[model samples]
Target: MVSIGYFLSCEEFGPRELVKQARLAEEAGFERLWISDHFHPWNDEQGNSPFVWSVIGALSEVTSLPITTAVTCPTMRIHPAVIAQAAATAAVQCDGRFTLGVGSGEALNEHILGDRWPPALVRLDMLREAVEVIRKLHTGRVVTHHGRHYTVEDARIYTLPEQPVPIYVSGFGPASTKLAGEIGDGYCTVMPDEELVRTFHQSGGADKPVQAGMKVCWAPTEQAGVDTAARLWPNELLPGQLAQLLPRPRDFAQASSLVGRDAVAKQIACGPNPQRHLAAAQQYLDAGIDELYVQQVGPEQEAFFTAWSKAVLPELR
Candidate 1:
């Protein structure tokens, strides 16, 4: 059976609310957790981006559900060595229930440091090296390295879990998917593409866990759910590399303006229909996902949790 987890959107909630949601998710019977790591909200409308590590620390105190970063970009904005320390601390706090999910990041988050966002291939290479640096530091031994994309000088993580934190690499395409298979302890993505999952398995990730995240909007009415989703997460509908290429919340907003409500309604599971949500999740299960993380978009948190616990999650199980 595929594990069903709740996805906490840092872009839409503050640290305290995220912690509260983690507790609620546990009560709702979700088996695990996935939280987004971002420096900025995709648009001003989404309105928040708390430092993810701090939120994870709070989550550890509040819920026992295993947590994984939906994806953090360690190649830029933050060095891999620093990420290694933070992830180590998080793993200790979660009692070894934490996973560090990494990826070749989007310019919206990585470009905030005024660094030039490298091309896709270069970014993938950097990610490979970054993961190497992180793995070295997680050994709890002194590590020093000079690599093409990063340099670590006598760094070591002191506060670590009894075991090394499992690192899950995120991939949206073939090259990165293959790299995740080659180097990652597991694999993560946002889509339900069966071919991508197959590529990961064939490349080297067979028997490794594969996780995917999807969004739904649960409101009293279908149209209301569509409106809420379109207003808050239209970026989900933006095609191609736009999500990766856009550098600012406003840029995302400008680009997202082209996304219409009809598109979002068709793509995302909306409203009170349990079958719609189930069908959405079934796609990921059909694609052979080991874990499926679901995010309820907009502000109907209580309604969403209540409905999913009673209607959706039990049925999925």
Candidate 2:
């Protein structure tokens, strides 16, 4: 059976609201949690980008659910050594129920520091090295790494959990997926691509946990749900590397303007239909995902949780 988790969108809600949602998620019987780590929301209309580490601390006090960052980019905007310390502290706070999910990252977040957004291959290489640095630091030994992309001199994280934090890598394409398998303790992605899962297993991720996240909108009516999803997350429909290349929220809004409500309705499971949500999750299951994280797309979180707890989670389970 696949474990179902709730995806707390840091891009959409404040820290307190996220903590509240974590409580609701646990009360609704969601087995685990995935929180997005972003410096900025994809678009301003979605609003609210709280520092993820602070929110994680709040969540630890409220819910016992295992939590994972649904992809943090440790290669840029923040150093891998710092991320190692944060993840280690988070693991301690969560009593070892935390996972560090990392990725190559997008320009929208990583470009904030005025660093040049490298090509996809270079980003993957940097991610590989970043993971290496983080692991070395996690060993509680003094790490002095002078690598091609990063240099860490005599950095040691004094506070760590009983066990080292598990690092899950996120990938969207073949190269990144292969890299994840080679380095990640687990693999995470947004799509239900069977081939990607196979690539991970073939490259060295065999029998490791595979996690994926999907979005849904639950509303009183299907049309209302569609409108909310389209308005808030049309970036989901932006084709190809557009999501990776776009540097600002306005760029995203401009790009997403081309995405229509019908497109969102067709892709995301919306409104009161439990069957639609189930089908969406089933797709990920069919792709051999061991863990599935679901994000409610808009503000109808209370209604969504109530319906899923009563109608959807039971069926999925």
Candidate 3:
């Protein structure tokens, strides 16, 4: 039996709404939660991006469901030591039900600090070192390091859970997958590509949980859902490294203009049909993902949860 989770989009909702949705998600039979960490929305239509650590703190008070950053970029903007401290406190708050999911990062978020975004290869190297720094701090011991990409001076995490928080790594390609296998307690990615999972296992992640997530739009009608998804998340259809390379929300919006409603509709499961939603999730399960997170895009959160609880979740559960 695969575990099913709800993905909270920080880019679309404010802190209060995210907490409320998390509560509703638990009531709707979801077993866990995946929250996105971003400094900016992918496009203007998505609207908001709250500080994720604060939102996670609020989530601790509201829901018991285990939470993980669908992926956070701990390499840039924020130092690994800071992320380590934050994750430690979050683990204690969540009663040890927290996982730290990190990635190399995208320019859209990292560029806001006025730092030049390094190439993907360099970022991966930074990610590896960052993971090491975080792990050392999580041991509740003072750490000092001078590495190629970053330097840490006498840093220690004071608040830690009884058990050390598990760190998961995310990847969209070969290099990152191998890194995840090498250092991650778990693995995360958006696509349900079995080939990637196989690579992860082969590289060193054998038997580790592989987490996957996807987005959908569920509304009264297929066209309504399609339009909503296209308007709010057309960036989903942008190909190649566009998602990683784009430096700002407007850049994404401009690039997304080329994507049509039909493309989004085809890419994302939409409408009232439970079968469509089930089939979408089934792909991840069949691909051997241990955890499956589903996000209902747009403003129909209530409808999406209500419908899924009654119709879709029962079958999947």
Candidate 4:
């Protein structure tokens, strides 16, 4: 049976609210938890982006659910060494219930440091080197690396898990799938596109765990859900392009406003029934996603979780 989880948006809630959500998720029987590691929120209206590592520590104290970075882009904004240290600490904090999810980040977040963002190909190369760097350090060995992306000497994770923390790679396309297969202990993605899983396996991620996420707005009726989704996720309507790729949440919001929310509603599944939610997840599941994470938009989070836990998840469960 496939495990299910939720996307805790650090960009949306306060620390107290976040802890409450974690407790609620655990109480609701979510098997695992995933969080966004963003530096900003898509809109000022959205209002937050707490440091995810700190939040993870909080989550550990509040629930027994395993935590994983739904996706953390380490190849650009932060050096792999920093990620290794953070991951090690998180692993320790969670008492071995943490997995590090990583990827090649976007300019929106990385460019804050005044560095030009590399093209996708170059980003992939940098990611490969970053992964190598993280892996070596995880060995508890003092590593000195002169690689394409980083340079370090005698670096080691003095406090690490009895078992090495698993590294999960996030990928949207074929080349990345291959990269994940080659280096990731598992894979994480936003869609459960099975072909992507096949691509992942072919690339080198054989027998790895897969994770996917979707958005929903649970209401007594479908129209309310649709309206809520339109307002919040108007970004879904933008033509598939780089704006969708910008790392800054404000950039994403700006792009969404330009594209308009009504247009995005056409693409999102803000439906009245379990079937629509199931359909929403099926595409990603078919894509070989091993875990499906759901994020509910609008204010009825408790109701949304109840409905999904009772109706939609049964089929997958």
- Alpha-carbon TM-score of each model against the true structure: 0.99, 0.99, 0.99, 0.93
- Tens-digit lDDT string for candidate 1 (1-317): 88999999999999998998999999999999999999999999999999999999999999999999989999999999999999999999999999999999999998877999889999999999999999999899999999998988877788888999999999999999999999999999999999999999999999999999999999999999998999999999899899899999999999989998899999999999999999999999999999999999989998899999999999888
The lDDT per prediction is 0.94, 0.95, 0.93, 0.79
Error of 3 at 11 (Å): 0.5
Error of 4 at 293 (Å): 0.9
Clashing pairs in 2: none
Tell me the spans in candidate 1 whose CA falls farther than 4 Å from its real position: none
lDDT of 3: 0.93
* Clashes, model 3: 0
Residue 272 Cα positional deviation in candidate 2, in Å, after optimal superposition: 0.4
**Cα RMSDs, all models:** 0.7, 0.7, 0.8, 2.0
Scored against the true structure, residue 13 in model 2 reaches a CA lDDT of 90
> What is the lDDT for 212 in model 3?
94
Best by lDDT: 2
How does model 3 score by TM-score? 0.99
Candidate 2 at 69: error in angstroms? 0.4
